[model samples]
Target: MNSWLEVLKPEEIEEIHAASLEVLEDVGVEFQLEEARAAFQAHGARVAGSRVYIPRLLIEQALTAAPERFLLEARNPARSVWIGGGETVFAPPAGCVYVQATGTARRSAVPADYIDLVRLVHQSTHYGTNGGGIVIPEGDFGSDEEKFAWLLLAGHWYSDKPQMGLNLGAKVSRLALDFSRMAFGGRPGCRILGTINPDSPLMFSPEMLASLLIYAREGQGLIVAPCSMAIATSPATLAGTLVVNNAEILAGLTLAQLVRPGTPVVYGNTSTIADMKTMAIALGAPELSLLVLGTAQMARRYRLPSRAGGSLTDAKEPDMQAGLESMLSLLSTVAGGVSIVMHAGGILDSFLTLSYEKLIIDEDTGGMAKRFQRGIEVNRETLALEAIADRGAGGNFLDHEHTLKHFRNEIWRPQLSDREVYQEGRDYQAYTLAKATQAWQKRLEGYSRPVLPEEVEREMLDFYHQRFGSEPVLDV
Candidate 1:
């Protein structure tokens, strides 16, 4: 394949690494959890209260011990996903609390919305990683315990694809592990993956650390991301923000290694720029793609799998702006060699809302990105010298067997984008919106919930009931 995309020189990457090491050694990172701090201290890091000064030796050791790639098992064996190497896996939008449709005002999402989102994910052809907790229905769900349980159970009920583990806290995270064991059995390797974020500006929060420790000890895959907004939580300059981002990620990665060596950790980045005047984060900005490229390069420098990019946008609705921003972000993501793509679809309003239309549109965008990542084949048959000679210069090759045999594999067909000539009455944007709306509704109409084995379903329910006192409701 082609070399893909890059945003930094080798020397620049080295500069970032050296600067990060200096920060870890001198400035230090705060590990809010005592266990995390203790783990760092035992691994030769200097500790003062919550601040842990991780030395270069520990960082290097951690880098050496961390695996480059790992497999995540799914309820269906065929749906298992490998989360590294040159592969790019797309996940749905996360943490959105509102739902929006075209020409309608956004509103608080309910449990029904969450379940439908899961169903959309289950039906999507492009989204490979099923990220549970795609949208949190805080307005409807009574308690954190109930909400987290519903998210986990809903994912099991709707999708057999590989699901992301919960990381809200140690308790919920451990519950996610229990569910994974119950559903997928006690097989080796990572059964599910959890996402953990640093507090940015050189800190790890207590809840995040608690979940991180649990995931590390249990040998589950972890994505250590730093979602610092430039000029707000981080430095105004991209390079400066990168220094802070790299440091925080390294600190978390080191802690995970200290807790358990050979842990599968994806170097993750959701860091983006804040509009200077308003101070609001802009996920759609070109700077986000630059950050994605830089983050992926940094991860590659350490020989680690990386996570970045998505169909991210600042648009409130699934309109033109959403499509433009989503394509740019996703294209850069695939070109930059991102392994796990979070928020790959169904996001709108700077992640405040999840739009069903965008999910369908972004899948087409993702298909295009994947096709581009495949690059072009140039050897003998692909060069088409025989086909050219068969047709000669003036005549067309439409009837040639070579054209017939090659076109299907060589061309990428979009599911949503129309290739036909526009009729006189059709409006392109309106057509897309109509098509996407129809598409998602049709999917939900035809959706069939995957059936878990009877005993496994009973065990998962029993575990849920034991953890949360009330009898759980499965119907959404």
Candidate 2:
């Protein structure tokens, strides 16, 4: 991870600092709601209509008050994850519709489908960590509350890693907390990945703020994702947009800290742009790649963990375009040293449709990125100068003991993928997509669902029934 090139040098970072200060001073952000305007005004900001001018000193003070690192606790403490100021961590993709294939066809994602995906991810040795409930099924129970319910159910079913809470209204947030309490059997800090969405112009909705407050008071981790679109909703310039986005994140962080000091928060940015001609959000543009890298750097500057948009593609089909775009964004974020990187797969055209095959392909891409982050070996054994001298010119290293000692450690083995000769293909004829599909099927077949105590499951269900007035449907 440290081997990757520094996108911003000291001078560049200084320039960004100056730019941010200028943005705060001159190009102030607007808060359309009067209450938010009054809050900022009361906090020493200069408010003119919807626009609020924040001084650099306040920004610095907020940065100082914010934490540099934190832990995301899980049902089991062994599964808890630490983010910030360390090796880059990879998380599977979040929030997509149909999972795409390498081929043109796509399939709708259901709650059960996401459970299977989670099982497969848990089973895979290659995937770094489990993020959350995979996909929300499109059906009669597609309300935001139901979506949050599904997330809670999925978290209950799986306990291998830190599970993410679904993004929903404040009522759903309370229900999710209830569900977590029931599933985990204890109310531990940082048990769930609490989320809050901030709309553009550096402001969060009241409901979003309320949800974050709930998580903060509980001492759980909070992920604030402000979906800023360049040239339409957010500023066109990258730096300009980053200032507004960073300010919004800082504001949320301040509130969380005020509620509970040292509360875990991840700096998240899904800032993108809409193509002017067609009004379609451009997920594959170079600007997005830049944003992914720059936002990562900004997160580091704030001394907090970062999550950014990824596995994005503009391709209608899961082909070269999809692979290229996803790889570019994924590599940039990983290289930029983002912790808890999100959106690993199942994304297209601003996260509307999810491609299953694309998801599988992204898993493979993530494997490659992880390999890159492992980087080159620097030890004497890796250098192999003595071996080179002893072998003289052109001797076979494959048969040597040194090769035997290191080859397995040096090489990465891939699953659900092939690297065979074409002439030997008839017996091994499956393509990458077909193999991935088969892998998922095999995973589903072999999975053994974790056994929660019957009493605990009943208690969770009873709580849901008490809250929502019905026996909660368990999709697992």
Candidate 3:
């Protein structure tokens, strides 16, 4: 019941695994950073100049050592989540450059927009964890550290769930780790979760490798994801892309375990095709769904959890095209049995823009998938055999106790994305936009900021002062 669709048979899974092993052993992968190359060489991987040929046995060893499941401890203990074991977690869309809403002009996001987005995440029932790097807030920062400090602080200030941010550099990521130590205060296990992306065509960037090493040492959560464009960065065929993508992910996993034997890493991906005519990345393609399905199968083979797929669309607005494409992509991701889907909401124009209106649409779309994911509970009470027996054949059960008791949990309702509500005076297109706008306004107006202790808030402020010139004037 985990998925309605299956892409790879058991034998096909073996074939893909063998191909990836061959690629890792014979073809080798380039390490753009000397430090990462040194780690592999130190761990007995054969290094040829800047390229490193990792042994298949080492890959198997790492896979055996990596945990099948783990806890990501949040700042609020009650908000902590367990990843893997077929359980899925949803994070709102993040890392978009531009922000747009219905009837409002599109523009670069500032600090206010970033804070608003974080607050919106805090208010949503659909998001399992707080989203991070939601916007690259506009600021005149003295350094990258300064910029990162403000952004991560905003994330902490706004939400209590597990959060994420840029993980390609060492200095800023380590700083974030230090902040987390203060935010969560020595809670056991993983408190920090991050996404470290590999350069497609089999390479890990210097910055990302540095970040990965720090995360591994800190016992933080990681999604060892590679974002490879099918025709551009990988072989055009889907099978070929999977082979490359798997090798890249395995190399990262191996490195994570090498730094720390039991490092928690998800077998992650962002592999999608390039549009033939436009040369733009095609996230809404049918092949993208297949890619996710295949990736999830490989992850299961290694007994690791998986990540990828999203409410993605190339449409510039939250219109009919966006709705259709987003629903299809979100459903495919859930059916693929993937975990920790990134960009699951608010993406538009292939990740160039984040539409507030679209975020509402995307959230509702993902909510539908979750409703489906709950499946059916066939217990004695849920079976309703007694209820039917109590009420005779001709008599209705609408007024019965069973119906009254379970009606709310039994029904799936969409607050803002009801397709049935679109047939009246307005088009589905216009209704969707208007409703999305209306939903966000209500959420913002209604959400109350979480209270922070005076001492902890002051310490966070001191950390802020060390990074930026002055202490932040926060509402919390």
Candidate 4:
């Protein structure tokens, strides 16, 4: 985590600081709704139409009030996640449209696709958390709400990885809480994921506010996202965009803390830009990468857990552009010490489409990033100053005891990515995309759904049935 600070020179930090202050003072931010304007005004902000002037002092005070670190308790305490300060967490892309399967290259993500994705995530040792509501196979479910419901059900059924629940209305939030209560067998605060969108002013919608309150009251962690778009929905400049994003996030954090102080929440930013030329959202832009890393730092300033965009690219096809963009943004966030990096796979066009090949590649990228975060060991054996002197020059250490001891520990072995020569490893027949397909298939073949007690599952399903007036399909 200290690496993040070390990477930023004093001048750079000062620049970011100055930019933040300018954003707070000169650029300001827009509060779309009157209620949010009223809230900010009540909270000592100056409001002029939709533009609000937030004093640096107020921003600093809010930062002071924000919790620096918190623990996300899982149903199994052993699996609980510490999301702030020193620890780091990862999440796959959410709300994507396609999934890659084994044997097949890529396929449209449907309800069944969700089930497979959940199962795969559950079984993977690599991924630390589960994200449902990813648009794999477009669900047969009636509406976005219904599709979200299916995601919640699949998450409950497939994984115990402290999953993110669906982001429907307040009723779904309540149901999700109830589902957690049942799934964990009355364990409160089992670390379910909830979202609060700051698309308007400083305030949350009644439904969203209620959801946050429910999650907070239950001791659940929240992932609040200010889906700000640069040069469009938000400020055109990066600094201005960051400030608006920060204010929006700060607003969510303040509300959550006020509702239930000390409730764990991640400072998540999915802010991106609409391309000036194409009028399309561009995730591959260098500015987006900088935004992600910068947001991580700003979140750290508040001593809060952080989440940011990752495995994101503007490429239509999963090619070099996709790999490069994903690697750059993801590594930046990881190095910036973001606790939860979402969009780790299957995102395109600012997250409207999901690519199976991209997902496979991203898994490799995520593995590499996690390895990078582990950093280099500085133990006596690893320092090897003495060993180097002993060997002098031109001595190969491959067969040495020190080499054997440190090499494995120092190196990261990738699954989907290839490093072999053309003649070796089946003539490098297995491309990462293909390997990912195989691995995903193998995982599904061996997949075992979480063993929820029959009665508990029945109760949860019954509740959904009663609420929706139909038997909830557990197929996915």
Top candidate when judged by lDDT against the true structure: 1
lDDT by candidate, in order shown: 0.88, 0.70, 0.84, 0.70
lDDT winner, 1 or 2: 1
Sort by lDDT, best first: 1, 3, 2, 4
366-434 in candidate 3: lDDT tens per residue? 888877867888889999998999997897989999999998998887887555633556666676678
**Residues 1-476, model 4: lDDT tens digits:** 23772344556655666665666567566544555456557777788877777777766665665567766555556666767876667776787775544345455667776676777777766566775576645645666555566577768777777777665556778767777777788865545877777763243555666676677677677888887779987779777777667767766665455455567778888888888888787888878777887778776666778888688887766777877888888877777778877777767666867765566667778878878877776767678987788787998777777787777768878777767665544634346667766777787899876667898888878877776667667674
| Per-residue alpha-carbon lDDT of candidate 1 for residues 317-430, written as tens digits (9 for 90 to 100) | 887888899889999999999999999988898988998888888888899999998999999989999889888879898879998999999999987888888699788888
Give the TM-score comparing model 4 with the true structure, all chains together.
0.85
Question: By the lDDT metric, which is better: model 1 or model 3?
Answer: 1
Superposed by TM-score, candidate 1 places the C-alpha of residue 379 at a distance from the truth, in angstroms, of 0.5
Estimated TM-score for each candidate: 0.97, 0.88, 0.95, 0.85
100 in model 2: Cα distance from truth in Å? 4.4
TM-score of 2: 0.88
Regions of candidate 1 where Cα sits further than 4 Å from its true position = 139-142
The list of candidate 4 runs beyond 4 A from truth reads: 5-65, 100-108, 140-146, 200-207, 385-394, 424-430
lDDT (Cα, tens digit) per residue for candidate 2, span 1-476? 34544556767766776776776667676554555556557667788876777777666766676667777666656766777766665666666666654544567776666676787666665454564546656654636676667667766666556677765656777777777777778766667776677877766666776677777778778887778888887788877777677767766665566566677888888887878898677888878878777778878777878887577778876667877888888877777677777777756656767665566667777777777877887878789988888897978787788888888877876775577667644644246668777766777788776677788888877766666676655565
lDDT of 2 at 213: 73
lDDT of 4: 0.70
Name the candidate that leads on TM-score: 1
